[model samples]
Structure formats: C-alpha cells, structure tokens
Target chain A: MKWFEYQMEVDQLHASDALKARLLAMQPDSQTSRDHSAPAQRGRAIRFPHWRRWAAGAAACAAVAVVGSQVLLGMGPAGAGISTMSMTAGGAASSTAAAYDAAAPEAAAYSLAENGLSARSAAGADSAVAGEKIIYTARLTLETKDYDAARAALEQALAAAGGWMENSSESPYDNRRSLSMTLRVPADSYEAFLAAAGETASVVNRSEQADDVTAQYTDVAGRIANLEGQRDRLRELQAGADTLADLLDIEAQLSDVQYQLESWQGQLDWYDDQIASCTVTVDLREVETYTPTGETFLERLGAAFAEGWQNFVLGLAAVAVALAGLWPVVLLVAAAAVAAALVLRRRRRR
Target chain B: MWRVSQEELYRIAVENYSDSVYRAAAHHCTNPIDAEDVVQDVYEKLLRRKGSFSSEEHLKAWLLRVAINRCHDLSRAASQKDVPLEETMPAPPAADHSVLDAVRALPEQYRNAIYLHYFEGYTAAEIGRLLGAPTNTVLSWLHRGRALLHTMLQEEIEDEMV
Candidate 1:
C-alpha cells in the first residue's frame, strides 16, 4: 500500500468509545471536588474566569499596601533608626505600630523605650512557636591558653549538658592545636550546652540559627496519610481482582504506592529526629591571648597602643632580616669597588 | 500570543489530539488496552500540568512526546513478560493494513520521524525538536524508515496484495 493509504488506515484507527467517555469524565485537580458535587456543570466550559483572578489580585495588593504604609508611617513617628530597632527589648513597638497606625504613631513609637532591649527582640517572634517543630543549630569558635586542659573541660561540659560529640577532628599547626567537633544535645538543654561550652573555653565567635520545619512536618504528615489511604484501597482492589492481568496490574500499582508510603514515612521520621536534638559545631583553638567581650573604652585604647608598638618593632625586625638575606649581592658590589680603587692607584703611580 | 484558559485548552486537546496520542502509543504498546492507558495518562497529565502551552501546536507536540515516553516506560516494565505482538494488537482497518504494519516494523526511532513527517506533516527540524534528536539524525531516520517501509511493502504493494 502507498504511504497515503497508510495515513488513511492510521487515521481510521480511533480510540474506543469507552476510553473517550472516561476521558470526558475526568476533571483536573483544581475542579475535581466542585465538578463531582454538580454533575450538571460537567459539560460546561469555564474560561479564564477573570473576575476571580481580579478579586484575588486586588486583595493581595490591598494587603501589601496596608502593611507597607503602616511600617513606613510607624518608623517616621517613632524616630528610631534601624540600629535602635535591633536593640529594642520587646515587640511592643512593632505590634502597637501595626495595630494603631496613623491615629497614634507617637504612642506606638514610645513603646520601643518601654520595651528596654532591642538586641534580640526581633528574632523573639519565634518564641511563640517554642512548642513547634524547629531544628536549632549553633556554630561556636573558641580559644583557650592550654590545649589539654581545654579539651578535657570541653568533654566535661558536654557530659554536664547531656551532649555527645557526633564527630570530631583535631590538628596541630605552628605548635598550637585546634579541635573541631559536631555535638548533638537535646533541644531542651541547648542553652545550657552553650553556657557550658563558654565556661570550658572562651567563645570567640558564636552564631545560632533556627529552621522552622513545622509547616513541612505537617505537609509530609498529610502526604503520608494520603499514601496510606491509597495503599489500603489498592489492597482492597487486589483482593477482589479476578483476572490474571488485573491482578498483575494491581500488584504493580500496590508496590509503587507502598514505596511512596515508605518514602514519606521516612521523611517524617527524619524531621522528628532533627526536632528532638540540636546540632552544634564547635571550633577550639589554642591562643596565647583572649579577645574578651564587653571591654571598657580605656582598655581598648591601651590595647590599640600596645598593638601599634608591637607592629613597629615587628616592622624593624622584618627590614633587618631582608638586609641580611642580600649579603651575597652586597659582597659582590664591595669586591668590585675595591678592584676599581686598586686599578686607579696603579695608573696614578705610573 | 492569545491566551486560552486551561479548561478550554484541555477540551481542545481531548477533541483534536486524543486519537493521535492514542495512535502514537498504540504503535509502541503490546496491546490496545495498554495504549488506552497511556492515552488516559497523557490527558491526566495535561489536566495536572501547572503551566499553559504557548499554542495549540505546542500542546499537540507535548501530548505526542508524553505519549511516546509513557509507551517506552510500559515497554520497559513489560520486557520480561515478552507478550507476542500479533496476539495482543487489535486488527487494523482492512484497506491499508500492510502499509501501517510495515511502518510499525521500522523501529522506535523511525516511528517518531515517520509519524511526524508523514501523518502530522511536521518538518525534519520540527521532528528533531519534538524527539530531542539532531536534525541530521531525524532526517536519516525518515530516509531509512521510508526505505525500510517501501522494502517491507514492496512485494505486497506491487502485485499480490494490490
């Protein structure tokens, strides 16, 4: 047969009426519930639905405008700079500013002075979610005068706080030793653990971060529930399956569903483990001097002067070493000068 | 550049491209039921998709690609069972049976080239984009598929079957 005949033959091959009927009955995820409730609407076509989108957009725009205006106006009346905002003690300023708005912006700003400290009040918002799923992690860089004493005290502190070294490595550089460790402690003992670590060795630099995984935990939990329902339904279908082909198909689907169920369950379990314990990576180094926090202005001035004098002495030593390193070149120049002098003297005598 | 709603696009796909997708899948599948499953899966995917197609042609190509990929997955999954093609495949229309059988026998790579070039009327370059193959490769597949189909149908088309 010609290729034209072949095209005609293939064109004649249409999907069965049953399959088309099934396709026609299918609804997308967004419309499934609504279509199922009103079967009469199944045949109707819903276009762009502009009004719905416009309504949602207008609501979002209004929300952003309201929040933006309040924050801007609140800052103007409060007369507090960005630096002061971080040092304020409480959320009183933010809350009142958000609530009262233009009616009494000054009253809202005054709450900042009442709140006391601004240092960590910004991040204190998560204090409300204390019972929620959060993964707390901290990184600490520490220094001590003696390596053996610091290392022993570090282990004692970890034991005191019910923490254990999950991983550790120690190395020596320039005759001084440094140790790095990942420690895991119960979430409840996290603050105590930090304090204990500070007592063991001076914490040079410290940073802590909290990952709020409550939303993800709930989402994965929901997926696991749905997968469990699917697996159970598939099992029911399997028991009732009559034909060999039907049984095989169901078995394949069952395995797939089971695999997905286990995967989601595994994820939820991991979240639980992370929420239960906190991971802190600590770096300990042997230092001759400690950089203490909360120093007086006078002490800082004295330190600055001492550092300058030390730098000057080091600079002179560096120059002297450089001159000594060029001795061979200096000796060659001196020898040339002597030979030239001897030749000049011989010519004068002649 | 004109925008069509997702629901409208979906209805259009069901009406226009369903048979083409079914045919594409049927060529690769061992049975018509499996082909039907692939077609169902292709439409379900279109329904679940979060983004809109650029145009009707884009939508059609997406359907064809998805159907072909699903067919490949089904074949891979059923490789161990090794069902006979003649027993599972439904009988085609009486007139041009030999022609389609010859085309189906050409191999998987040739089917995309042959189907797109012959039936869908896509250019060699368009088929390359659809199949994710180089233009030269698609051209050669079309060339080789045409030659192979002709050879397979030569005796039947020339005298006895004609």
Candidate 2:
C-alpha cells in the first residue's frame, strides 16, 4: 500500500534497448529531412512529428520577427513621419535614419540631405501644406545649461502661446536631470512656440508634421448631423405615439438615437480640438556642454576629445566606488591569511 | 551533441538517462509505447543538436526538458481526439496495479510534479527550475498532487477490501 512503490512501477517503464541502437546508428546526413520513419504509419511515432514541425515553424517565425523589427528601427522614421514625409516632406526622406524631433536646422538639413536637395529647399514642401483642417505636431530635443532658467522661459512661452502641459516626466541621467513633456498649444502659435523653445537651449533635433484630417472631419461632422436629426425625429415621434406599446417602443428608439448622437458628437469634438491645437512633445536634456553639430573637421575632433576625457574620468569614479563596497570581504580574507601564517610559524618553530 | 560521439550518445542515453526521460514522460503519457517514442525523439534531438552542453547534468536536464515538452504536445493532441466514455472508464486495477492506475489517473499538472518529487527525489526548488516555475508555486503543486494521490490510493484500497 506504500505510495513509494509507484517508483518501482515507473522504473519498470523505459525506452526499449533497440531505440538507443537505432538513434546511435542514425546518419547525420540523413537527419535534415526527418522522414526516416513514415510518421503516419506508426502506432507511437505520429505524435512527436507534429511537435517537431511546430517547433521548426516557430523558429522560422522568430527569425522573421527579428528581421522585421530591425527593418522598422533602421528605415522607418519616427511615428508621425508617414504623414510628414508623405505630404509636407516630398515623401523622399525615407532613407533618413534620424528619427528624433526636428527643432534644429540639422534635422531638416538631415532630411534635406537625404532628399538630395539644396539646403533649406525642404522648406518649400512645408510651405506647400495648405490644408485648413490639419493636426499639427512638433517634437523638439533641446540641451540646456541652466534647467531653472530654461524651465521658466518654457513656462512663459507656453503661457504666451495659450498652451497647457498635458503630460510631463523628469528622470535623472548620470546625476543630470532630463525632462520630457507633451504640451498642447494653439495651432496658430505652433511655429512661434517651437522657435521660442529653440532659444531656451541648444536645439539637438526637431521634427514637424501636418496631418490633414479634413475629409475625416467632414465625414464625422456629417454623421453627427444625421444622428442629431434622427434623435430629434425620435423625440417628435414620441409625442405622437398612439398606444402604450408604441409610446414605450418610441421611448426605447429615442434613447438609442440619443446614445448614437452623443457618440458622434464626441468624435466631432475630438476632431475640432485636434485641428484647434498642436501637440508639442519636447525632450529637454541638461548637459554640461552642447554637442557640436560638427559641420567642420576641427569641431568633430574637439567633440571626440571632450567625449574621451569625460569617459576616462567616469571610469575612474566607477572603480573607486566598486572597491569601497568590497571592504567587508577584503577584511575577512586578510584575517584568514594572518591566521594561516601564524599557524605555519608555530609549526615551523616546533 | 557532437561533444558525445555515436557510441557515447548510445551509452549515455540508453544506460544513464533514458530511464529518467522515460519516467518524466510516463508521468503524463499513460501509454508506455508513446512514452518510449518520446524517448527516441529526445535522443534524436540530442544527436542532431549542434550546441555543446556544459556538463553531464546539463545534458540530462536537456533530455528531460525535451521529453516533458514532447509529452505536453502528445497530451494536447490526445485530449483533442474524441474517445467514448466506455473506453475512458478506468477498469478495476489488478491487486498489484492499484498504485500505477492511481498515479496515472492524476490530473496532468500534478502528475509530473508528484512523480518527480516522490519517485525521483527532486526537491521543490529543483522541480521549480526543471518546470520553469517559481519554487513556491512548485511547492503548492506538490502539496496538491500529494493530496490527490493520497485520496485516489485510499479509494482504490477501500474498493479492493470490498
């Protein structure tokens, strides 16, 4: 009755000895096809081949996923680049690898370079955008020497542009704090606000986009009008109902119409809000010095030397902190060594 | 896999670790023939694998993991196939087979944990690593599996007495 006896029953179960001989005798050259056994004809062999195929298919899918992600990060611009590049940017900047914000001339120049156009010629594409109902979005990456001054100036500029902070996050990088924030500014002042942000600090990168939503806005507005008409008709019908059942049925239909009307109204309101204001996301980095937009050979050399010096100082500090944390272990090892030496001295004297 | 040659693979798998792999598979696969087939597949994978194992224990663990995965696949396939209730109904166990039937009839999740813990002497921590679950979760699985096994064995003994 002992449950441990179950182990003996399990012990009696094992792979047949012939299976080992067969496995050892398998030719490596012949294993690639894995069709050694007619898998369909076997009593027990059929189950595992299904999983073998599944595992192989899974591995192939993993490889595809890896390559697909690399393509995304390599060629694709930042999220809104589809609309920006498609309409305002001549749709020829697909080869541009820089996907950051476009506040700096270098970013526009970067795209301009990829477009193989003359400097500042990309501006023609931006100026060609004439859509009345468009959602404007601007992303800026700035480097600042003084966070408090930069922040105060940012606040003053936001107030001037009639903008409000929507979402903001601040985190420290190597003892220096960096702030990322999303702001909503009136579309009229989006260009002025970005220019003001550039003056706050050294602009590292910038990108601008105009998403034309006129057709979508008109379609939603039309739907809202239809829903409102239906709701109004339903309300008028409720008053003219002839029987209790008709009255109740009309009431249900009226409520359903009211729900659809509100839903459509919400969509129309969202479109209106998007057209009225621009979403400006800014990344403000606090740096000891600005990175030289190295258009010259001397500037590039100076930046590389400065970076090397900074890295060497940081490495020394890291080693000092690491040794400081190992004091207890060092003490223990020292104590053991002293004790062992005393024992050896006593044995040698004896 | 090439680290161990053809003769070495046969010796290590058939003599050293095939029983372990077979036993791990058997905890889930009630059919002995299917369990043996899983063993052969596990060794076949080892032979074809290009990666070198770090140690003998690594080789054994690899075999066990492959065996368990194959058993999972086989069990899933088995579950989806239709079987009449009459065929699935457990026959009265022979006086000696009450233990095996009781063990075999355990719910699938508990079967591997119970067999590895009770028969193979794997602690909850070792079972946790083998099954890729947290140690605390493996402890609970062992606890529940043990309780289920005790109840089934008790019922079988009572029936035998009658």
Candidate 3:
C-alpha cells in the first residue's frame, strides 16, 4: 500500500465509528420531550379573563399613582421646616465658639468664624458667629467604686475653679450618675476648671470644641446699626410735613426696617451669651459590680442553640409572610415563565 | 401509478433516508446522537411542508439541506451552551469504523465534502447543491482534504517503517 493509504488506514482505525453510532442513539431527555409537548395544549388556559385583565391594569395604574403622589407630598411645602438651629448666649458678653488655645487667639477666632460659616453653609444649615469670648467645653466620664468620694472631689474642684454643675442626672437602676453643666469660669480659670473636674472623675473621655462667632456678631451689629440709621431717616421724614400717602408708605417702610434692626440686635445678643458660657456634657458610669464570673461550656452551648432557634423561627416566619403577600404576583409570573419555557423547548426540538 | 398520503410519504421518507441523513450529519457533527437528532429534525421539517417535490433528486436534496442545516444549527447551539462536543455525538460503528473515523477526523469543510463525495457517492456539483456552496469550492475542499490525508497517511507509513 502507498504511504498515504497506510496513514489513512491508521487514522481510520483511530477514528471510532462506534462513538458516532452511540451518539446517534442518544435521545433528548424525558423532561425536554414533555416540555416540548406541554405548550401545544394549555397555552390558552392560563390567560386571564377580559374583566380581570382590566382590573389588573387599573390596579397597576393605581399603584403607580400612589407612589407618584407620595413622592410629590414628600417634596412639597410642608416638607420645608427650620433649616438651621442657632444656640446663642443670653448676654452681651462675647461667647467663644472655640476653645481657648495658647496660640494667636484673635487669628484663630477670625479663621474659625469664616471657615465655620462656609462649612455650615456647605452643609445646608445656618451658621452663627460668636463674639470675642471663646467658650471651651470638656466632657469627663468616670467609673469609680467610691461614688461619694468622687462626687466630693468633683464639687471641691469646681468650687475652687468657679465652675458649677448646670445639670445632673442619677439612674436608680445602676446607681450611675451623670452631670452636664455650663461653667462660666474666667478665661484664666479654664485650666483650673479642667484639673478640678479631672480629680472628681477618672477622666475616661474628653473632647473640647471651639467656635468663632466674632464675624457673625460683628455683622449682626453692623446690620442693626444700618437699619437703625435707615429707621431714623424714616422718622425724620415722618416728622417733616409730607403727603398722607407718602407718610403711610414711609411708616410701613420704617416698620419693616425697625423689625430688621430688632432681629439683628437679638442675634448679636444671643452670640454674646454663647461666648460667655462654656457648655459641657458629661456621662459617669458607676462600678456597681466588678466581679467577673465564668460560664460553663454547656451554658454557652445552650445559649447558642437558643439564639439559633430564635433566629431560624423568625426567618421562617418572615419568609412565609413575604410569600403570602406576593403569592398572586408569583403565580402569574411563574405561569408566564413556564409557558414561555415550554414554547422555547418545542421550538428547539423542531 | 403510485399513491401515498402525505403522512405515509413522510414516514417513508424518514424510514428510507433517516439513516443516510444521520450518517451525513454525523460526518459533520462528530456525534452520533446529534446526527440522529438532525435526521429526525429533517424528517419533521419534511412532514411540516406541503407534499411537493419535482423528483427524487429534489426530495433528497431537500432532506440533505435540512440535515446539513440541522447539523450546523446543533453545532452552533452546542457552542453557545459550552457543551462538550463529545456529548452530542455517538460512537461510530465499531466494525468498518476506520473509514468513518478517517472521514470525520478531517476538518469540518473538508470532512463534509469527502463524506458526501465518497461515502454518499455525490459529485462535486451535487455536494455544492446540498451544501449551498459553489461546485468549485466543493472541489477545492475535496482536493485539500485528499492532500492532507495523503500526507497524514504517509507520516503513518513512516512511523510503521521505524
């Protein structure tokens, strides 16, 4: 035989005819055969009645309307409320919005007033400027076995530093007491106040914030001054002889300008009080029981089992409720899906 | 005069040409099951159509066209599903298998031409009609397949010589 013929023979041997025969004999799965025949019979059965279809369409429209109306309501005028809240001082004293640090106090206050305004405005909230006095607040948390001793030390420290408790709360359940107060210690006595408060508590956590409202205060004062000047001019015009209509108009304008001047003065005075007093929030945790007890392995295992059972039951209930709520939609969608699947299978067979 | 219902004609067509169609499809599909499926599908198509053909040649061409189309369809569908090629193909008949094996091992275009020309005894023109290719193209595929076979056989002979 030629070289070509010999190679052909070998290749012919390696290529198994049995494999092809076996492949030919293979049949489509029973499921596929059944699925192929399924759609030809009941595709007409699952369709909804005309009235039901109309009802479904109406329901769908109603659902869309309800959602649209809800979104509109949420965005309407009622949604607009106070955009910002300002905490102002009660007196003319400049209240520092910032904690007093040893560096250039005036420069720090200036940057704070400008930067604070920008930051608050960026946050879509109103920003207030404080006067020259910087209010520094420190919160002290203490956990002590000797509550009376801790209280006595704190009181003495506050008295020595001219700091007093503004508010105090005691929880009966745990014997845990907390005190929150604004301390109006002079600028020089701030360190002393901190040290005194530190002696009463273990000083678990402390945070101090500084706010500069000088620019805001000055702006308000300047506005009040300008409005007063305008009001004065209006009054002078009122004193001079003028037409009745002009007098009424001038009086109205003067009232408006006076109202603005009063508003500015009110804002300026509030900022002044904020600078004068330092407000601090303190939380104290009492060590009522410090003894630690070990749990047995069985006890821990039982707890884990209980937790697992509780979670499983809750999960099952939630799933059941969800399925119940969605059963109508699920059934309709599933019927459509199954019908589509059967049709596709039959098409493939052909 | 011979008379047969359209259904009988369909049955007759299936019985007579199904195996042939399967063999033709098997050459391309490399899988016996897929070949059988292609044959069945071809018969189904024949049954679906109005009973009309000018001659046996036309009928056979129609069956061949359906078989070839089905084979290609099966190949494409299998590729989309990332199915293993071996699953759809059956083992070729064990006895006298070497011929079929050698025929199938050829490239897809080459194998189809050689199978139709040699196994089915189709001229290049007839293959062109069935394959929807130009006669010259069918001839080229046959020529190239033969050349490749010759080279491969030659290599085998050298291996035996060693």
Candidate 4:
C-alpha cells in the first residue's frame, strides 16, 4: 500500500474506543438546565462594564501625561542654561558671581588631599603615616549616651566620605551602654568623620600606625612572573602533544602549574585589596544603659498557633477541591463497570 | 461564559486526537502505559490552560504542538539516562511485520511530518509552522518518511506471506 493509505489505515485502526466514549460523555449541552442552576446559586451580580473600561482609559491618559511631564522636566535645565548664556553681558556676569558664591563653601569643606587618598599620598607622607610610613596603625575610641543614634550618624558620615566599617559592636556594662565600630574611613575623610564622630560622643583615645610592604610586594611579583613564563611554555608543549600519553603527561604538569598560579593570584589580590583601602578601628560606648521592650508570652504563643492552623486548613482545602474535580470521572467509571457486569450475567443466562 | 465550553473541548480532544497522540508516543515510547501517560499529560495541560481559540483548527494545532514537544522531551530524557529501549517497549508484531515496525521506528522528525500529513490533513507548510521548521525541510521529512515507510512496509508484507 502507499504510505498515505497506510498512514490513514493506522490512524483508523488505532482510534481509541475508550477515549471516544469519554469525549462523547464530556460534550457540553446547550441550555443545560442543571448547569445553569449552579451559576444562579451564586446570586447574579450585574457589573457596569463601561465603568471598568473608562477607568482603564483614564489610567492610560494619566500615564501619558506623567511621561510627557518627565520629558519636559529633563529638557528644562539645558534650555534654561542656553537662554542664560545668551542673555545681556552684564546680567551673565552677575549670574556667574552668584553661582560661584553658592559653590564656594562646599568646595572649601573638601580639601583635595583630604578627599582622595592618592592625592594625600602624593602631597607627601600620608598625614596619618607621616612619621612611621611603615608599621603604623590608627585606633579611635568614642563614647555616646545613645548608642543607636550615634552609630547611625557615624554610618551616614562614613557613607558621605566613601568609607566602610570593618567591625562594630554594642557592649552592655552596668547602666552605661557602649558601641565600637572599626571603620575604614577614606584617608581624606579620616580626619573629618573622626572629628565629627568625636563631637557625637567623647573621644577617649586615638592612635595611628603604618606598615610598608614594598619589598615583599616586589619579591612576590617577580616570583609570579617567572612561574607564568614556565606555565606558558608548558601550554605550548600541551598544544604540540603528538600522542595521547604525552598529552596526559603535559596536562598533569599544566594542572600543577595552574594550581600554584591561582593560589599566588588569590594572595596577590588580597594584598592589593588591603593596600588600596586603609583600615581604621573605632571603639565606641554609650553613656546610658540600653533597655529592650517586652511582649507577653500568651500573645506570641496565640499568634504562632493561629498561623499554623491557617496553613493546615488551606492545605486540606486544596486537596479536597482537587479530589472534587476528579469525582465525575471516578463515578462514570464505576457506573460503566456495574453496567458491564450486569450485561455479562444476562449473556451467560442466554 | 465562553463560546466553547471546557467539557466540549475536552470531549473533542479526547475523541479525535487522543489516539493520534498515543500512536505517535507508542511509536517513540516502548509501551502502552507510556503512551497513556503522554495523552493524560497533554490533556491535563490543555485543561489547566484557559485558551479561547478562534476555531477548532487553532485548538487542534495547539494540542498537536504540546503533544509533539512532550514526546520530544521524553525521548531526550530517555536517551540521556541510557535506557534500554525494549524493556519499556512491547515486542514487535513479528519479523514479517518489519516494514510497519520500521516505519513506526523512523526518527521523531520523519514520523511527525508523515503522521500529520496523512492522519491530520496538514500540508507541508502547516507542518513546518507546527514543527518550527522551514517548509522545504518539512517536505524533505515527508519524502524521507515515505521512502522509509515503503521499504519497511514492503519487507513486512514479504515476511508475512512467507
């Protein structure tokens, strides 16, 4: 037979009687009285369709208006700048003088050496490391009455100065509370936020230390460069490997070299991260005690029980609904089985 | 609330297309149970999704796409696990029926195109869209499937007569 004829025959022969019966049983009836009554049980609540449509239309218009305003606002500054520049020469001079006056105090507050560590180091020895450029460390201790408020203010100052906290803790001792945050304030802002933190609390102690690792850095760099050259030679050997055995041998050697290189790179990166950013340790204490608020035991227990019960009921309801949907198929199967058995008994008697 | 009811959709799908999915899967899968599994999975997915299709053609096309994807996914997963095919498959009708077996055993791409063209009345272009392939690729598949089918079927007829 032709392929098409065979395909059609296969389709016909394989048509599932059971599937067809099930599909026939599932066909929806028009104006089905029993199904119509089910929807009526919910109480027919009419909604004005136009109201929702109008609301959606209004929302779209509002969104367009907002976008239009943002575009105009973005263009406003550039437009204003060009118009001001094109104004009378006398007026332009007055505007320039006013702008400079407004910018002066902000510029004065940030010293070039104080705002950038590279700039500070280039000026001469870093102020904090002037005497001992090697083996120098700085320690600061601050005391505040309100630990949280003092910590928040210190954090804000650190963020404004592009600084980071290394370690911080609140210690309880008698009626007085204390906080100590080890902060790595920007070398430029080290003097500024430190002074500000001191104003927030009392400055108990201040110390600075520096350590130079120039020789160590140079030694490690030389070793890494030598190893990288060796590793590159091994890679060339691996690429030119003629036999599988030689390839495997080269791979083993390459693996060892790569491992050592990665270890050296990790150590170098750690050293670089530490050298790039200076570390400052600050110890702070509150002058007053910290007292935490309390909640009743029964209230906490009751809330936990309520949440557990709600979850349990929801899980049970989901399972019940799933089983309910499957019940129709189950019932249909049961009825068919009973009918089949009855027919079989009748045929046997005949 | 909708023009086509879920029950009607379910009925039409099960009656007309269930066996097609089963036969397609049975050719790819080893056993009737797996074939049944594929059909159940396809129908359950259709029921879960609320698709208001424009016509019966759209609905049938959607179902076919889902079935083909499911079968392909199952076949790929089966291959990955290094499953021995026959353990999951029924024995062939006999050596005499080699052609029918071989045609059924042709790879998924060929089987699908041939089946849709001959069984579901799909043209090569229609098959291309359904299979996410070019029309020429689908035509080649159909031609290849026919050649494979003819060889296998002829072998089976000779074996049966002997």
| Best candidate according to DockQ | 1
lDDT of 3 at B16: 58
Model 4, A11-97: lDDT tens per residue?
Answer: 554535674454344323321122111121222121223667899999999988865654454334334433433343344333323
RMSD of each predicted structure: 40.8, 27.2, 25.6, 33.7
* Deviation from native of the Cα of residue A54 in model 2, angstroms: 63
Instruction: Give Cα distance to truth, residue A123, candidate 4, Å.
Output: 49
DockQ by candidate, in order: 0.16, 0.14, 0.03, 0.06
Scanning candidate 3 chain A in windows of ten residues, the lowest lDDT window is A83-92
lDDT for residue A46 in candidate 4, whole number 0-100:
19
Report the C-alpha displacement of residue A342, candidate 2, in angstroms.
13
**If you assessed candidate 2 against the hidden native complex, which CAPRI class would it receive?**
incorrect
- When 1 and 4 are scored with TM-score, the better candidate is 1
Best of the candidates, lDDT: 1
Error of 4 at B42 (Å): 0.7
Q: What is the lDDT, from 0 to 100, of the residue A208 in candidate 3? A: 55
Q: Write model 2 residue lDDT over B1-162, tens digit each, in one string.
A: 347665575566667887788788776665777776777777778767777776677777778777877776655555456452222233344466557766666665576677767777777787777777777777777677666656655543221210
Task: Please give, for residues A1-350, the per-residue lDDT of candidate 2 as tens digits.
Answer: 66546767777877677865665566555553442332222223212225678899999999888655543442232223323433433331243233233534455555445544444443334332233355667777787879879988988999999999999999986656899999999977877888898799877666676554545666676777777888788888888889999999988888888888788889878978987888999989886655555555576445544544444466677887787889898889999999999999999656
Interface RMSD of each candidate, angstroms, one decimal: 12.6, 7.4, 14.6, 14.9
Best by TM-score: 2
